[model samples]
Target: MRWRARVKQLLLVGIGTAIGFNGVAVAVAPGRMQTAYGIDDPTPDLTVLLRHRAVMLALIGAVVVVSAWRPPLRPTARVVAAVSMTSFVLFAFGTGVNAAQQRVAIADMVLLVALATATALPDEPRPAARP
Candidate 1:
């Protein structure tokens, strides 16, 4: 594979893993919201919603990671990742994020740039078919 294609794949893998791990952690321990987002005392209803969001994040991350190796899935994965990151960034800004949330927003912005660069890069060349 060409250097650009390799770089793109690597970016997808790294970012996907980071996102997935975070989701899993939060899913396993919903209390993380208190520390991560400064939620002092979340109601039971809030906990359920947060856990659901964590699952969605994990699914999004899985799609992104799979797309790294499956070119055919790239378009959908890109859309998923873009929407996930864009929504969080917009919501954070719109609602006035706390310090921890601000950090997450910044990281999401950086990841968005990386995702854009990967998308802009040339795709890998396919092998010639046999006669």
Candidate 2:
């Protein structure tokens, strides 16, 4: 039980941090993000769109991080994380696999597995009642 809790905590924090950092990077430096993602034809309109997507990703990350210790929010956080990660994974694959794209897809795949495992674990046991 202790180990389960620790695993859950670690997954939540790690996934949230990774996602949030990516969001910040995309939002703050779209050109750099494009380069990193192997995008070569970035326009002003695309940058705005990417920034908006980054905001959404950042919000999701924030929710996951905050919900880690909040039992009430756990289910929703897990659901959102699963959906977002799954979507990203699918998108990465659909975009076709160059070396760079394969790296992104693989990372997302690992994150998705971690999120699923964390979500599947039973909730923490409540404290015993007084006599």
Candidate 3:
């Protein structure tokens, strides 16, 4: 495989780890907001938000893993991964603008940008479609 492909493979692995680990963390420990994120009464909102996040992250991780394992559907998986990354940006940026989640917002922006970039590389065509 080309060096570029290797790089993408590593990036996919990294992002997959990020997504899966973060998913489990948010689900199991949506910790105190005042200390962690500076948000008050974070539990209720965090519950709903983390649940959504966990689902998205789990899906994103699956996409990354699948893409890295095989070229087939990699393009479409990349697009879906990009959408997931973009969704993080949407919430994070909005939180930063209106809700003052500065750190998480910035982090989310950076991670999303990285994931999107990693997934944008060219890949072989997907395997033959089934009926």
Q: Who wins the lDDT comparison?
A: 1
lDDT of 1 by residue, 1-108 (tens): 588878989999977876777787778998798776677688999888888888888888998999999999889988989899999999999999799888888888
The TM-score leader among the candidates is 1
Give candidate 2 misplaced runs (Cα > 4 Å).
Answer: 128-131
Clashes of each: 0, 0, 0
Best-to-worst order by TM-score is 1, 2, 3
Score each candidate by Cα lDDT.
0.86, 0.79, 0.66
What is the C-alpha lDDT profile of model 3 across 1-131, one tens digit per residue? 36767777787777677656666565666663343355566567667886577667777777777778777756776677667767766776765543445665566666667677776765545569899
Give, for candidate 2, the lowest lDDT window spanning 10 residues. 31-40
- Compose the digit string of candidate 2's lDDT tens values, residues 1-131: 78888788888888887777778788888866555466677788877887888888888888888877886888898888778888877887887756666776687788888888888877789899999
- Give the deviation of candidate 3 from the true structure as CA RMSD: 4.9
Which lDDT value does model 2 have at 59? 86
For model 1, the superposed segments whose C-alpha errors exceed 4 Å read none
Flag the better candidate by TM-score, 1 or 2.
1
Superior by lDDT: candidate 1 or candidate 3: 1
Candidate 2 vs candidate 3, lDDT winner: 2
**Candidate 3 collision pairs:** none
